[model samples]
Target: MRSLLVTGGAGFIGANFVRLWARERPADRITVLDALTYAGNRANLANVKAELVVGDIRDEALVDQLLASREVDTIVHFAAESHVDRSISGPDAFVETNVVGTHALLKAARRAWLGDGARRPHRFHHISTDEVYGTLGPEDPPFTETTPYAPNSPYSASKAASDHLVRAYHHTFGLETTTSNCSNNYGPFQFPEKLIPLFLLNALEGRPLPIYGDGMQVRDWLHVEDHCRGIMAVIDRGRPGETYNIGGGAELPNLVVIDTLCRAIDDAFAADPSLTRRFPDAPAARGLPTASLKTFVADRPGHDRRYAIDCSKARDELGYAPRHDFASGFAQTVAWYLANEPWWRAIRDGSYRAAA
Candidate 1:
C-alpha cells in the first residue's frame, strides 16, 4: 500500500477509489493508468490530485514501463469493458479488453514482481462483478466465493475469464493476488449509462426511463463508497489467492430502485428548487412526477433474473460491513447528482459510449 498503480482509475469505481485514497492516504504515491475512453472521464478525477498516465491496460510496453519506473507495490486492476448492454451489442471489445487486456496486466505484473528473483512483495487486486455467478433462482441463496462461475452474458463471461487468470497467477506463478466480486454500485462520478445515473439524468431531462423486461430483474445494490471500502479491506488484510464477495446488503428489483430514485430526486428537487431551471425540462417541474417517465423495453438478452452476494467472509474475516443504509446512501446519491449537474451533463450530452 505504499505506491499504487491503479488501472482504469479515471472510471467510476476506480475514480472514486483514487479520490478516496488521495484523501485518506496522502502519504501514498498513487498513479492512474487509464485510456480515457468515454467511460473513463478525466473530470471524474479532476477534483483530486494524482499522477495520471494515459494508456491502455493491454499495452504491455506501457504497463511494464509504469511497473518498473514507479516501483509500484500494489496494482488495483479495475480496467475492464463492464457495461452488459454494450457487451450484448459488441462482444469483441469485451473479449479484447477484459480477457486479453487482463492477461497483459498479469504477465507484466508477474514478470516485474516475481521474475529475476527480485521477489518484491506485491499485490494485484482485481475488482469483479457478481454477475460471473450468473442469475440465481428466486429461492437460491446468494452467491459465495465458492459459487461456480456461470456467466450468462458476454460481459460476465469475459470477467469470469479474467478472475480465473488472477487465481491462476497466484497458484501457478505464485503472484500475490486477491479479488472481490461486488454487486451493483451507484454513487458519485458514475457515467450516465448504468441504471441509477442514467435514470436520474434521463428523468431529469424528461426522457423515457427504459426498464429492461418487467423491471423485475433483481440486483444487490451496493453504494459505491461501501464497495470502495470493501475493496480496501481486501487489499489491506485479505489473504492471497482468496476471493471475497462485497455486497451492500440492499437487494431489490429494478422497478423499486427506480421508484426510490425518482422520489429521492423529487425531494432533492424540492430542496434545490433551482433544479427546475437546471434540468428545466424535467416533468416534475410541470407538476408531473418523475416516475411518470418510466417505459419498459425489451430486456437484455440473457438478462440475469437475480443476483445476491454472500459476503459473510468479508464481514467475519475482514471486519467489513456497509456503513450507509440503503435509504441514506440513495438519498445522498440523488443529492450529489443534483448538485453536480455540470459534471454529468458534460458526459451525458456527448457520444460518451466510447469504450474504456
Candidate 2:
C-alpha cells in the first residue's frame, strides 16, 4: 500500500490516522477526500501535510478521478454519518452517506482498477462500528469477527448495509477489501456530540452532566490513536475479504466512565480552581467536583445496552493490540481537551455548525 486515498480524513479518527500514517510512513503520499460536514474540521489537519480534497464520497467522478490520478493503491474509507443520536433525529443523511456513498466508492474503485496491473497492492479498508452487531446481554460474550450484524439504530443499520456492500463487491468482483468493526473511540479532535467529549466539556464548564437511562450501557472504549494503529495493521497484514474486530479491552459502564472523568476533572480543577472562569455560565468552583453536577436525562430510544468486541482475530492475525489502558487513556484524553481549548471552543461557539 503506497499511494493512498483516505476518505473522511478530516474527521476525528481519520484525522488521527492521517497524521499518524504520515508521520510513520513518510514515504507514502496520502490524498484525503472529505465533505467537511458539521463534525469535519479542517483544523484537525492543521499540521497534517497532505493533498486535501473537499468533496462528497458519493461524487463518483471525483472519487474516480482521485483514485486514478493519484494512482491510489489503498483506499481507507472512514467517511460516514456516524452519530446515533443524530441518526435518531434524521436518518436520511445516514443512509445517503454511509450506504450510498460506500457504494459509490466501491464502484469507482472497481472501475479504477479494472485491468490495471501496475498497482501491486490495491486494497479497500472499510472502517466500521461495533454498533452493527447490536446490543449484547450482560452475560453474553463480546462480539467476534463472525458476529451476525443486527444493527438497532439508523446509524448502525446504514453502516451494516455498507459493510455488506463491501463484502459483495469483494466476492462478486474480486475487489481486495478488508473491514473492521471497532468499539467506541475517544480522544483529541472529537466533536462534542460523543459521550466522552460531551461529558468532558460539560463537566469542565460546570454544566449538568446528562446521564442517559441508568448510565449503565457498557462500551469497549478504544483510544483514537490505538484504533488508528489497528487500522494500519489491517491495511498492512490483513487478508482480503475478511472482517476484523478492533477492541481496546477497556470495557466500562457509562456511569463508571463518567465517574472517572469526574475525578480527572476534579484533579485538573484542584490544581487550578480559577479554571471554572473559562466557562462564563459555569458555576463558581470553590472546591466542588464536577461529579456533583450529574443529572439524569431521558434515555435514547433503541439505545443498545452493551457493545463490546472480541478482537482476537486482529490480535492473533494482524499482531494488533491496543496500547492505551482505560485509566491512563481516559486521563490523557481529558488533558488533551483541557489543553486544546481553542479547538473545541470553536465548535462550542457555532463556527462549525451546518448551514441553514
Indicate which candidate wins on TM-score: 1
Query: Which parts of model 2 are misplaced by more than 4 Å?
Result: 115-120, 277-284, 352-356
Tens-digit lDDT track of model 1 for 77-105: 99999999999999999999999999999
> What is candidate 2's lDDT per residue for 160-255, written digit by digit as tens?
999999999999988999999999999999989899999888876767889999999999999999999999999999999999999999889999
Over 4 Å off in model 1, which ranges?
351-356
For each candidate in turn, the TM-score is 0.97, 0.96
Candidate 2 scores a C-alpha RMSD against the true structure in Å of: 1.9
Go through the candidates in order and give the clash count of each: 0, 0
